[model samples]
Target: MSKITSIATAVPVYQQSQMQIYDAVRAVHAGTEEEARVLRFMYKSSGIETRYAAVPDFNLENGRNEILHIDGADINTSGLEDRLKIYDKAALDLSIDVIRKCLHEYMNPSDITHLITVSCTGMQAPGLDLSIVKELKLCPNIYRTSVNFMGCYAAIHGLKHAHYIAEKEPDAKVLVVCVELCTLHFQKDRSIDNITSTVIFGDGAAAVLVENSGSKRAGWELKKFYSEINFEGIDDMAWKISKDGFLMTLTNKVPEILEKKCKDIMDHALQYYGITSEAVDSWCVHPGGKKILEAVERGSSVTREQLQESYAVLKEYGNMSSPTVLFVLEKILRRAEQNGSVKNIVGMAFGPGLTLETFHLANA
Candidate 1:
């Protein structure tokens, strides 16, 4: 099996506080006092206090003004072509930077035999995978795989592919890069679902290096991977491309459904390897939102202490979609080194299919 050697992440430069975003949205939806009040409530209740954006004009009043007259009309009129242009230009730089950071002084770029690129926020013909190869100067003959439109669970999906490659070729070295510019898809609508999505999604990228052998470095050993979908929740979360941008539908009942189903999904995944819930000492869960994390805590046997890393990532960076879970896993890896070594780490992420993707890890 493959073992993850290192994980690195990069966020866009523009950081906006929750209050700034709320004020900006309120300006766009002016004349609706009740809607503004509800927006304020949601911002305050959202666990995310700050988020990063690729575009500096995330706020209605991006620059200082004497009277603070924001061009709400221009901000709310962004179309699909406009957003895709930004995604195409900004995606490559962020992806390359994080991958370079992951390999710097640790591994040689020429040693990489497989490249896996993941993204659900943007689409391109040549794809960012080819750009990464040319920029990083990896092996020209390396095999490449693209895991697209899988949503937040894609990191696990990429890892599953890496695990298979490593099992087949012991010398295989795989690099998985997940980049999502979620902020590019913001909608000007006033629906509660739209508000919830706009409040939490951000822009970020993560790169992970995994190899078949556990030699010359210390990291998490990949044991197994599992996946399951809740058909009843098929409508709870979804993403579709439209004229304006990608539209996302997120229902309030998703947390309750996840809380009710997570245990069963986990049980089914763990039983295959003869591992019990009690054996897991670390938990790296995707912080989809405050409610989602809380629901997972309530349903699972894992203690709150084990889930703190997930909460910290949510608070600091918001949800960066597919790259978010890897950020949590990176934190867990660092924490294990600071304290004592931990065994049997379990990582989980949820996506549009109301799907639950999980993987088992251990220190070799």
Candidate 2:
């Protein structure tokens, strides 16, 4: 079985407290009393205390009743190209840092036979994989793969790709890195969807090293992966490219939709492994938001304690899109090390297309 040996994460330097962001939103949309009231309620209850952003605008004026200005210029007028420029400047640096931490002392750079890059927030040619190879000085001929624009579940696809490669080539050492600059797409619109997306999404990246040798590493083994889609939620969550930046269409019904579908998906995955949901020792679920976690817990019959990693990552980092789940997995692995318990972990993530991705992991 292929083993996930190590995972490391990195975030930009600019950190914003949730209250600061909430205050900024209120100032931007202080239009109607009802709107202000709802915004206050939503931001206050988002279950996030702090998040990191690639841009420092969130720290500009303490988010008072004023617009966001960078060097005395409004950020709302920033265009897509401008955001992409920021992404170009920062994504590679963050990716390199994470890859270094993930593979440092654990594996030799020359031995890395495969590299898989995952992201949904930004895309450009001469993609991140090329830069990673050059910067890390990996084998120039190493096999490379890119999982682009798959949203939060993209990491699962990256893992799946590595799993297949390692299964085919027993000597393979794969690196999976997910970087998302979600904050670069922040919109100035006051629409509920825009506000909700802007408030929850942040910027971060994570890298995982996978090997098929089952070398005595303190990490989880890849067992089985399961996936399903609920077309009913087709319109609930979506990300699309716009002239200004990527636009997110996040509807309020997302939590309810996930609540209904998670049960069937969890049951199917557990049964395929000849186990029940309760048989799993732990759950590393994507905390898309607090409500998403509450929905998954209720629908999947997984207790809140089983989801503390999800909640902790959500509260500390908000949502970093694809990389967020890796943060949870890292936390779970750390907990396992401290307690010395071999756990059967069920890791799952959701994304656009109403996609539900689940994986069964066993202590290796």
Candidate 3:
């Protein structure tokens, strides 16, 4: 069995309130008073208080803007090349920071036998995987894998791979790193889809250390993983590379679709493990948005309190794509440590295929 021994998350230094981002987005996208009003309402009801970004220009308080100028001068003008350049530098820095924190007092960097890098917002050859190797000075022969363009649920794939590696090699130590620079793909457009995506996505990175269960460490033991895709909602959520940064097509229909399918997925996974909903101590649902959380609550046996850590992560960090779910799991792990009790955690995350990924974990 493989167990997650440690997790660490980090966001860029440039922090801004949801309203601050709304004002910048509206300045470029809203053409009329009514449009601005609608945008304001969306931001106010987004259930997000603050979000962090790799770019400082997101904070209008900084006086000058390089990406989203309040004057609408640079709206959609920054090409894909420019956005990726920022992504390359900021993503690597944030990944290194979180990985160092993840390994601190937990494990030695050189001992890691495998590394998995994940992202959806940015991509480049000689990608984050290689950069992490050089920056951390890990073993030159460390096995490496990259999960890219998988949208929000990509981190779970990384974890799944780590679990398999550990199970196959008892002495293996795997490090899974997910870093998303979602804010770099910010689009200045009037469409509801564009505005909604802009309001909810943020930038952050998270790292998890998974190792064989023989180690004498208390952590979450990997049990089982299940996945399903809602083909009908396939068109509702997508990520595409464009000449001008990456584009996101996220519609209002996402929550409704997930609401209808979430319970079936959860029930199926729990039954396979002979576990009941009530037996689970925590539910780490990805906080895609306010409506998504409400949808999960109504669809599954999970209560708002059981999802409190997810809500708290959303309220504090908004959605940082793949790394967001790990942030919630980290909170759950911390809470269990404080209480000095074992926990049964069920985790779920959604993404571009209208994909649903669920996994079970128990105290080791």
Worst 10 residues of 3 by lDDT: 68-77
- The count of residue-pair clashes in candidate 2 stands at 0
Give the Å error, residue 94, model 2. 0.8
Q: Estimate each model's TM-score.
A: 0.95, 0.94, 0.97
What lDDT, from 0 to 1, does candidate 2 have?
0.84
lDDT of the candidates, in the order given: 0.85, 0.84, 0.89
- Among these predictions, the greatest lDDT belongs to 3
Candidate 2 lDDT over residue span 256-334, tens digit each: 9988888888888898877777678889898899999999877778999999999999999999999999999999989
Order candidates by lDDT, high to low. 3, 1, 2
Assess the local accuracy of residue 29 in candidate 2 as a C-alpha lDDT between 0 and 100.
56
List ranges where model 2 is wrong by over 4 Å: 32-34, 61-75, 216-218
Query: Tens digits of per-residue lDDT for model 3 on 250-340?
Result: 8889999988989999998899767898889999899999999999989877899999999999999999999999999999989998995
Clashing pairs in 3: none
Model 2 per-residue lDDT at 251: 89
> Candidate 1, overall lDDT?
0.85
Q: With candidate 3 superimposed using the best TM-score fit, by how many Å does residue 324's alpha carbon deviate from the native?
A: 0.4
Deviation from native of the Cα of residue 166 in model 1, angstroms? 1.4
Per-residue alpha-carbon lDDT of model 1 for 1-364, expressed as tens digits? Answer: 6788889999987888988877766765444788778778888898988898887655655664211234635544567887888898789989988988898888888889999999999988888888888887888899999999989899999989988887678777889999999988877666767778888899999999888864456667899988998988889899899888898888988999988999888888889657888888888899999999999988877677989989999988899999999999888888888986678889999999888899999887
